[model samples]
Target chain A: MGDAGKMNTTHRRLILLLLALLCALTSGCRRDQDAGKVRIKFWTFPLWTGITGNEKDGTTEDWPRLKIKEFEKTHPNIKIDLEVVTWQGGMQKLDLSALSGTYPDICYLATANLPKYASQGILEPIDADMTPEEVADIYPNVLDCCKYQGKTYVWPWLCNALVLAINVDLFKERHIEYLIPKPPERGWTYDQFTEACKALTFDRGDGHGKVYGYALYGIPLSVEYQMLTLVLGFGGQVYNKEGTQFTLNSPESIRGFQFLMDLLDKYKVVPPGPAGMQGGQVGQMFANQEVAIESSTSGVLKQLKMSAAKGDFPYFNAAIVQPPHLPGYKPASMLSVGGYAIFKQTDARKRRAAIEFARFLTNEENCRALTVIGQFPARKSVGNIYPGDVDMGVVSRLIPISRVYFTAGAAELNPVINNIYQSIFTHAMTPAEALADAEKKANKILAQDALEKGLDAKGGKQ
Target chain B: MTGQDSTLKRIIKSRWAYFFVAPAMIHFLVFSVYPILSTVYLSFVRFNLQGNTWVGAQNYQVALSDSIFWKSLANTALYTMVVVPVGVGIALFLSSLIFPLKPSRQNFFKGAFYLPQVVSAVVISMIWLWMFDSAHGLLNYLLSTLHLAPISWLGESRTALPSLMFMAVAGGGGSAIILYLAAMGGIPDSLYEAAQIDGANRWIEFWKITLPLLKPTTLYLVVMGTIGSFQVFTSIYMMTRGGPNFATNTIVYRIYQTAFEFLKLGRASAMALILALIIIGISAIQFKWLGTEVEY
Candidate 1:
């Protein structure tokens, strides 16, 4: 009897050791799994939330109110812990948690970043939890960005198509009344804009006018988004119609490149030399009554309105419109989105809970409320419910017509575009030369990817 | 039998020595050896969207083929070339000047110069970026007094790298100055007397004895300076963000772009490994060629 008792005690000790290791492996797994409740952790990028209503406790007030209200209505026993992270350093914090095997259940990051984390096996596939009908609910083209192969990674939260903001007061002062797109069809053609900007530019002899019609930021998104407007306006796309092949080297694309150059050299609408000054500087110029017409995101309009409400930028009476077209082309605007993703590390139970939470977050009412925090909702239903002084009627006009430029290999295309701009703007390469070089380099990269996948051999789509 | 028992006891006695050595050895192995070896190992792999996988020398091949990596390497070389000597030279000069000052004044000056050494590089870079602003900068305002046009210090690609070099030279006052000062203190005054008796002028004595004596310190400063300059991310990031174009992109920043931003960890590892080898090679050359000889 004594011998049997000792063996039993030893076995118990070994079992405890194994349990400790299992706990360590699933680092964030709660010990009290049978203890009557489920807990999920969620993170939000602070930048995703626009500075809302004047309250010191806005974050605490807003997050709890929504989370509690939704949870009480849906799953009263489920507990949610909300955390906020800034865009600038959010990834690093998450990276540490991931490395330690204690990552959050769900996180809202830029959808563009989905590929990187998904490849790391840190993010859970959304398809495993959600049905095909449910996946269809997200905005088209956006779901493509979040998926790697056939696996869904995140819910597409917001649609933020780039809308041009032109200062009407400055335009009127320069007698360039038609530059501001007050009416839908009556916007400036490319040549008209060029001539108008030339007329607006008055070199004040002593040092000349520092004012510019367009102040483009040096970053890739700023360059690409604006270039897409120019590219599509001139009948160009980054890829062929099916997007399986690269066609950025086509003659149509070259025309688009030439137009951007002509804006600086022939038209004088943009800043001189290789310098890149952003819309913030442009906005300040508008506030000081310097520039007439500029291209920027509509998000800036909200910021301007907030300042206008406080009477800070009193003269900043700017209006939003679709980006101006070339003399004869379809109007085009690119979209930028902040993404929300559920990780692969998330278990079945947690993944379901995350998907359920995502549905609650993107439901028209909550999505509209989310945008009050400063995000643009992806769904038209949410836009219809948007509560603000601005005309949602005008906002709805672009919903049907708007499109997100997408390709399976956006990751490869983005860097090449940045390289092309850097090379061309710095005078290291010319416009046609840069385009050709980018195409050649990009095709090789795509070919290598295809070869690695053995897609061509198998007759599979890239 | 008693002799055998005592021999076993002696072997047991040395067990305490293992206890003494194990902690430090384990710490070094875990922190230094493991990281370097893992980086070297990772550099050979390839990471696509699916995940990282072993792809023999593909990362290295790609890194070598990449123009950006080469450009960043060249930028690092230029930065090190400019900042290392200039920083060390200025530090040497300041140390020499302060060495002859009265004791209390010397201490005060030394402390003042060393204060910046304690503050972080990010703080220093931020302050300099504000001062170098093209529109509302103190540097431009100061230049305006000379009836000269204001310079766009960081805004222009041509001038951005040089302005960073200037910041490095100017702000290198503290730790370097103290190192040189300590070295100067240890130099025997008797040698100066012997040189003085030989009718050598101040410049000759300085060149002949003082300069030779300063070699070890100079070697140390140069190695440290070069290593610091090669890893010039914080300043570039805090200010120019690798360009007006890719002009300011350095090896360290490129690694950051690849590993952290782009998430090509394998390629980033290769780039970082190459940089480490270059730094080690340069330091070895400096030590081999110029490290001072010692007398017992």
Candidate 2:
């Protein structure tokens, strides 16, 4: 009845109006959809972004925009929405997306992650629509990486092979040319590699003048990827034939691991404090000519070339060679396959569109783009993509012997591998002790994972 | 019957005030409260992307039996034990030294200490990475000058956790100093003046007047600092990554790895609940012990 009462009534009405406006504004902001057009959300990491067209253009969608535009010309009814995620923590992002039922229609996945994603039933099978001829074109080794339970879940794209890259100038300076592996020869034996390392390692009187034979990142993940070469070359297997048990503690594997430790402790040819170093640091040391040899991969090569172009890198003449193997054992290299996977979609049309786009992306014509990033096309028909380039020529030759470093349950095994290296480098455990501990922990985790998946301890169906 | 109004009538009477606060309350419930409740629910289930199955206390049982979990808890406890008290003491000491200075001088010191607080934790950890580098780090360089054996600050199990603690003690006092300074400003200067007039020396006056009055500020710092130390992940994630054989691993880092990396969301939730309960228990103990003496 009074002035204050009138003010209160008016304020309440205003607040109600504002609240209604807020609700309407939020609700109206749903993602825009074009009439009669199927929108497919595509997510990818910066794979193949080293190509000229894939460079950033002030948007996250740039790397794959050209390809999308080409695809859109033929498929008028389907629209592509692309989001490029970073390699770091991308798997977690994918996991979260899958959990929320908001995953992209298509995304890039690695072989390491394929097992987990495929087992979750979040991925659509790629083989369902593939022609027999199309399937046969892909390299069997790389293509097999995409399969789970006889169904292909990923469209094979590229094979990432890691090899030993030695500083040619350092070898020349040490007069160890004969020790380097030349063509027509398989890699040197462990004794030969050790001899070369001793020869190349030298100390200068200046404070900054020590050049070690080799320097490697001792972090667990890096060890699993880079140092696994030693394990494999020494005739060690990460898992038993049944994929049931950890076998890195076997005598052969222990010998391999001991050789790595000996390189640091006995030979003292590697720089100190490898336990604290990261992969990038060792790469930098190689570029800076502080170390003689490094375990180099296609990704590292891409980085090195980019740095050189930017004039930010200390340039060096490098040669690719096979990692040293034990006598009577074949030399081996680690390969990580990169590929595109289509997520399970409710709409049949959207699923078809996704498969078509995936096929187009991996076609022979577009496969050449992989060369820019130092990746080998997954299709054997694509063949010798590097052509005349000497370094890649060596890598192409090595691809036949390359093996997938990670298999099912890699997420569980990798951390254990990392810890074993850490324990050894920190002197907390000897090589044999560390490997035994790793086997124990990894087996428990793998067994638990297998049980959760309704499988036997050997990763077999019950 | 004479005093109480009907619920609808009471709500109508204060309808305008309630409307003004509705947005904030809704935001809190959606972002904070809902997630917490979800986590608690999830702690009792085995979460799958397809569906979550109820498995009460199994995740907790797994965590309790795991040796790494216990090690991580002990590491977190050790980190909190060293960092929280040391962090509070540094803040108190710095605040006491700066409180008597001119406003401009106080602001200078405050800004200097607060610089790390403003800089991203990732950037600070990167800088410390260089400082802690065993072969080329500044600390090793300093030791080399004195003809002492170089220490692997983050590469060795014994030194990794302590190195992190030192970093925390050094860089963690900025916000606490600001809080302590504000608390010190609120204390009537007459208390210090009366103590001085009664022939109490500076040290005696500080021990009797300044320190005791700062109890409330210290209590807040200790509780918050303890919580912060227990949740340490960035420095470990960025610098050590719980490496050197898990010497630097903490509860939060393990939880993050479980939920995100390994996709054991249910186990992560259970570990999180356990952590929450532990923090709550510790906070309660802190309040009981320190809250008894507060006067302001």
DockQ, every prediction: 0.19, 0.25
The residue pairs in collision within model 2 are A220-A418
Best prediction by DockQ: 2
CA error at residue A367 for candidate 1, angstroms: 1.9
Off by over 4 Å in 2: A1-37, A48-63, A184-186, A220-223, A455-462, B1-5
Error (Å) of candidate 1 at residue A64 is 5.7
Residue A422, candidate 1: C-alpha displacement in angstroms: 2.7
**B240-292 in candidate 2: lDDT tens per residue?**
77787888889998898778777778889999999999999999999998885
Candidate 2 achieves a global lDDT of 0.82
**Model 2 C-alpha lDDT per residue in residues A1-462, reported as the tens digit of each score:** 899999999999999999999888776653333457788998998664434534554344554898898899898788998888887777768988987888999998887787777766789987768899988888777877788756799998888677888888888888888888876343778899889888888976678857888885655442357877876787888877556788878888888878888999999988777777776777777887788888877556666666787798666677777788777877878777878899988899999989999998888877888866778888889888876776777777777678755566666566678888788888889889998899888888778776666622223221
Q: lDDT per residue, candidate 1, B1-296, as tens digits?
A: 99998988986898798789989999999999999897887786655433446766877888888876787888789988988888888888888899999989999999999888888989998799668855446897799779888776765567767888888878876898898888888989998898889889989988988888888888888888888889989887776656655677899988987776656677889999889989999989999988869541
**Each candidate's lDDT (Cα)?**
0.68, 0.82
TM-score of 1: 0.84
Q: What is the TM-score of chain A alone in each candidate?
A: 0.78, 0.86
